[model samples]
Target chain A: MATINDVAKRANVGRGTVSRVINNEPFVSEETRKKVLKAIEELNYHPSSFARGLASQNSYTIGVIMDNTMDKVYANPFIYEVFRGVEKSVYEGGYNLLLLGKNTYQNGKLAVERVLQGKMVDGLILQEQIIDSEYFKNIEQYNIPIVSIGKLENRDDISWIDIDNHMAGYMAAEYLYSRGYKKIAFEGVELEKIFARERYEGYKEFIGSKGLSVMEANELLQNIEGVICLDNIYAYKILQRCKKINKKVPEEIGIITFDNYPLAEYLQPSVTNIEIDLFQLGLCAGSEMLNKLRNRNCEVNRIRIPVSVNIRETTR
Target chain B: MATINDVAKRANVGRGTVSRVINNEPFVSEETRKKVLKAIEELNYHPSSFARGLASQNSYTIGVIMDNTMDKVYANPFIYEVFRGVEKSVYEGGYNLLLLGKNTYQNGKLAVERVLQGKMVDGLILQEQIIDSEYFKNIEQYNIPIVSIGKLENRDDISWIDIDNHMAGYMAAEYLYSRGYKKIAFEGVELEKIFARERYEGYKEFIGSKGLSVMEANELLQNIEGVICLDNIYAYKILQRCKKINKKVPEEIGIITFDNYPLAEYLQPSVTNIEIDLFQLGLCAGSEMLNKLRNRNCEVNRIRIPVSVNIRETTR
Candidate 1:
């Protein structure tokens, strides 16, 4: 419960200057105003007794911080399902979500600070793998609860609810194998994060430990009988390349992909996809966030929602 | 500013119950708690003086309300582009966005009231057409500003920014004509709102006034020389139908669509689309909300962002 006096002292400015910035009045220089704001953020100062109390109290708002840029996030169908699931759970738990993108690198190192500065939300939901080291830096100080959508090695302390990416990858390979394709290869983006890496690791483990054949893209088209695409976009692109080269599917090669959205079902020959319940993952994440809100220190929970294969024309 | 007594009297409960509810204590009856919460919401009551002042003051938060359900809204790529634009403008303006879906009918009437109850946001940026009549129910009393993404005949009073849908329709027909297609037809979903209708109306106007030929999906496939798909999904479906029937694009039948994202560029012969700057529309919508926040009683402004034709293999 920091007051205006504390803000003024920390900012090295007069009490009147602090009051001016708090009241949003004129006569305060930009430098002085910024200093006051920084101090206020640092001290978690609220102008009135209630504002200060509200800082420690419940706002009943849950925030979502997407680690990826807007283009990457919005273009994919994964968010739509996951967010809807979250929305369903949050609303059911009497909470509303604040959407934030991590693209605000210059504004603040971590977007989570925005809510902490205002005491705007009781908890937060982090989507995707935690890449930036700055994300959970002072998370303990603010005492805000967080739940991740995907599991990573570095994000061990946080309560995470995720669909088993490793299992999903294994299932992609197994599905193609059952379709009678013997020499299987895996296709993935050149540079990817932990979740994508987990998928590749899972696929690699299942593809036979001894004498692994060449599995890269060009090699995949030439040497492999079937290919498991790690990404939906990569799957679509491979299909395009195959078509351009006049390679016949299920005859020359068998193609299988995971979590294809907005297009895979409609893509010509209608892609054979491993449909993941991302919506279920989102719903569970929201429920987990509520659990964190209602009962604090109730042991960090780890959950894995199930996945299944949606067989289509790409595979025999 | 509402006092605790106002809430107590209004809720027909003792001051202690009201205080308990305000402090989020246990032992209050669910019925009585609902009454107190409703009373608090209706009266805009805050327990502390600073909380009361903060309610009337700027929360420095902007909200985005999508009037559609999760499945319908998330399946489309429009939200990704639009919201990113809103995020850009709002962050630059030093504000954060609260994302709300209108699917909470049983929980509450309108999703916008969730923010208004706590004075959580200074303004809101609405995505898509306003279908629900209850949206702006008590907007005047709240004094929070709003900017809409699309135009509906009913939502004329609110400040709105939109792409030229009618012009987009006309452009689709014009593009087909330039590509040597004599007859053009329009395909849309069975049920659509103002935005979709506006596109059809614009295309119809451009297709010729006297004795318009039958332009339904079946008729377009058989009789019509070319077809302008209203929705991106419809465009993909039409292309799939063409592939099934062995209809060669730009030769047997020309095809054109609007605002195709994530898939249109990848859909085989690809797709010629009318590209709308939905992100820019969102940016302007956010900027408009800021302007409204800065200068109250400002005249409402309706802006139309420009559009362009992305020529692809679909239409020669």
Candidate 2:
């Protein structure tokens, strides 16, 4: 119900300036823009959304698709920090986020297509498991910008934000090896996810180069001492099995994994692993998204968040 | 762009039947209604939102306002699971969720009020912290139905869903005693929060029953051999300080805390703590909100989620 005049007064700006800002006209300085936004937010102004939509042809909304829904792994502070960064950037850019859960049934295409067809969002942030190249083709037809958090095989043109999975795996293996761990094992999902594959490759190559044959079980999961996991759940399962085999972690074998989920530390001996800077990933994604929304050209793309090895009771 | 006719065809139902189902008119059987809704969701048919808005005077949307934007303890799997449960129930009931982050600025009332006045939502799910009471009052004026995940000290009449914090605290003390931990400490935020204060009282009373006195650290902290913490960060800091003073965990002292954050498992020896059923909380909140929105005479409020102990490597 608040008019432009009230907003202008509260923002300490001229009425015409407020009008221009409301119209989203160019040439307004960043300081003036901040003032207008602050006043608008403070006054609880709801601009005629219908009118703004007709004039600007933009919705100022982004759709975020995440694979995990309210599980313990998503409870990690790292993921939340990234979300905070994403939220902060979006608020500053005057965009709101709509979260869509990943439909394991592959039926969520309805929601995705609806948002696209209705123009409900200006962009999409995909955080699901890595998909094949064909899925990218399907998404590309929508013509809206998308930024994926996980790598998609055989696709490089699209924007993505991820962590260096290969290096993280290498680091885990090297760290375990340096601590005099000879027998180790890797445990993760059987899925063909890009992250999992890359980390597996890294672990394999590093161990192979060290003149040691990677052991394996004669059946089921043959020939593995140290364990590399796809997620914390699988890692926990591996731990339970290790106890059955009388293999104590970091004593007879070592363990490591990606996506330092919250429950990792609570496990006995505490799983020492690498930590991804998810906040930086979200910040980078949001920045690129804002640029895409404003039609501004930016060189940012395919950013990889760094990782750190969190040494705990699991290793030593 | 898909119409009711498209949904009807996909569902193999008549157009008239689809119309009746969409409008919630009489004569449709429960079985038929389920089929129609499944088809509608599958087709992503947003059935006459404009018409529904005009006729029913309600938007099929609910706003969720959450506190603690930082990943800290708030990122517990319990919180996310609750949200997931809420999401599933609401979407099935034909409602979309709008997530609003707690704006930390000094003047956040305006933003909170805007959600109500702007007609962006028909109801609200408020997750409040101790410091956000002023903003809470501003939103309460709209008199729209609200269900909170946590309780407000001053507002007794509002509907809320919460875990039994007092019982959880009592249980933490009991767990330590059963484990032969005689001396105990309590660490959490300043005693302004109800959860912290209540939990501490529970611990004190239970320990006192066993004829044990809690050690005091001058004025800074209540020093004991074991600890029941409010959050992981405080638990980490407390444990670090305890180590500096030559107090070893589980060996010299035992520890328990409320809210098992993801990183709790990754910490050395992991952390033994109380786990609230967050998913059930969300489901209960969603179910209650739906009931309130559907019926005018429904006066039921105040639901409590159960909590459980996640026994990990922290205790003997």
| Complex DockQ per candidate | 0.16, 0.15
Candidate lDDT scores, in order, read: 0.73, 0.67
DockQ of 1: 0.16
Error of 2 at B202 (Å): 2.7
Candidate 1 structure quality by residue, lDDT tens digits, B1-316: 4678999999999988998896579999899999999998898554442344354455667888765454543356566567767876787776777777666531444545545655667787776444335555554456678788877466566788888888998888888887888778888834366777878887878876534553777933887678888766678788878877878887889888886667556556778899888778878988999899889889988888888899988887
Fnat for each predicted structure, in order: 0.31, 0.15
lDDT, residue A142, candidate 2? 69
Model 1 per-residue lDDT tens digits across residues A165-256:
77887788778777777788888844456667867877777776534553766833776778888766677788877887878887888888
For model 1 the local lDDT of residue A70 reads 40
lDDT for each residue of candidate 2 in B22-79, tens digit (9 for 90 to 100): 7789999999989999998898686544344434557666766655455543344456
